[model samples]
Target: MRIDKWLWYARVTKSRSLAQKLATGGHVRVNKDKISSASKTVKTGDVLTIALERRILVLKVVALGKRRGPYEEARLLYEDLSPPPPPKKHAEPAVAVRDAGAGRPTKRDRRKLDAWRNDT
Candidate 1:
């Protein structure tokens, strides 16, 4: 199956066109070989390396789906090999709060805010 079609059928991308763009844009690799065309064929057991926003996915194809299916069905198409994402760190809350009706900060207010930001 074409890489783009497989990606779409596997529910990796929202559409086949986006899969094509991703493949042609150099964000996809098949069996460690970079694929420059969306028409590249993929089969069972081929490892796919896909780079998505905020995370990289490594998947081993287990099946060639005939249609774009539900998430449950799609889950059976590939084996995820990517590591879990790191936990998020809690950040300190903002120290300053203005009234809802407050207008733009004055120069003096700006200075105070800058000083407060620097202190943290």
Candidate 2:
């Protein structure tokens, strides 16, 4: 079971091209080392660490798939080694503030400030 095929068969990615892209872009790792080749075979019990979106996934191969299949069948190809960690909360960027110690505003800043004052 090649890594890319397994990934597709497992429904981890939508298409083989996407899987190849991810692998080639150094997003997929085998035993912690990045693997770019899609043809790399993965055996049962092999651990894979994949980076998708914002989080990393750790999975263990449980079975080999000879062909791509339905979602239910594909899921049997691998076992999630560990449950994904909860998403970390991200604070929104703080609004920019003028530094009072700047002494004086630039011409543009003054105009903007005037507009803000008018709006208020």
Candidate 3:
């Protein structure tokens, strides 16, 4: 099956055109070989490395899909081998706030702010 069609059928991309772009733009690889065309053929057991929005995917093709199907059906098309993404750490709130249009701090104010910051 064509890589683009397989990607669409597997639900990796929202549209076949996007899959084409991804393939032609050098973001898709098959069996460690870079594919520069959407028409590249894929077969069962071929490993694919796909780069997407904020992550990378390593999948082994399990089947050549017959049609664009539901997520459950799509899930059967490939075996995911990518590692889980790292957890996000929530940043702590700012220790100080300044209102809009606030002018630059005076020398004394700067010293006081520095002292407060150091104390924390």
Candidate 4:
């Protein structure tokens, strides 16, 4: 089954979009390498490493759910291979940077900024 679907059906993530976004952002791993697509196929015995909040979840696929099911049934889909990692050690959230001279950017300013950033 597709990794994202499995995640959703297994109740690992609340929604498929969240799962896809997490995968595409390099937060989800199969075995050890990052995966960036919801359609990536996974099978029984495959190990998945999921990074969430401040912890890492290591799971082994025990079965594939053919469809979305009840929470208890869904939990049967995978086995927790390792306990979640300890919460990140007192890390402060990154602060957002604001442009010094900007008093609310205009549409043209936004376009120029987009072009400049996308040029790379």
Residue 56 lDDT in candidate 1: 99
- Tens-digit lDDT string for candidate 2 (54-97): 67888988898888899889888787876758888988645336
Clashing pairs in 4: none
lDDT of 2: 0.84
TM-score of each model, in listed order: 0.75, 0.67, 0.76, 0.67
> Model 1, 4-113: lDDT tens per residue?
99999999999889999999999999999999999999999999999999899999999998788899999999999998999999886676878889998999999999
lDDT string for model 3 (19-99, tens) is 999999999999999999999999999999999989999999999989999999999999999989999998876766667
Report, for every candidate in turn, its global Cα lDDT versus the true structure: 0.95, 0.84, 0.95, 0.84
Collision pairs in model 2: none
Residue 37 in model 1: lDDT: 98
lDDT of 3: 0.95
lDDT of residue 23 for candidate 2: 83
- TM-score-better candidate, 1 vs 3: 3
Candidate 4 lDDT by residue in tens digits, 1-120: 889888889887899888888888888899887887878999999999988886788999999988989999998999998784567687653533457886887798778867866775
Minimal lDDT window, size 10, model 3: 91-100
Question: What lDDT is reached at residue 76 by model 1?
Answer: 97
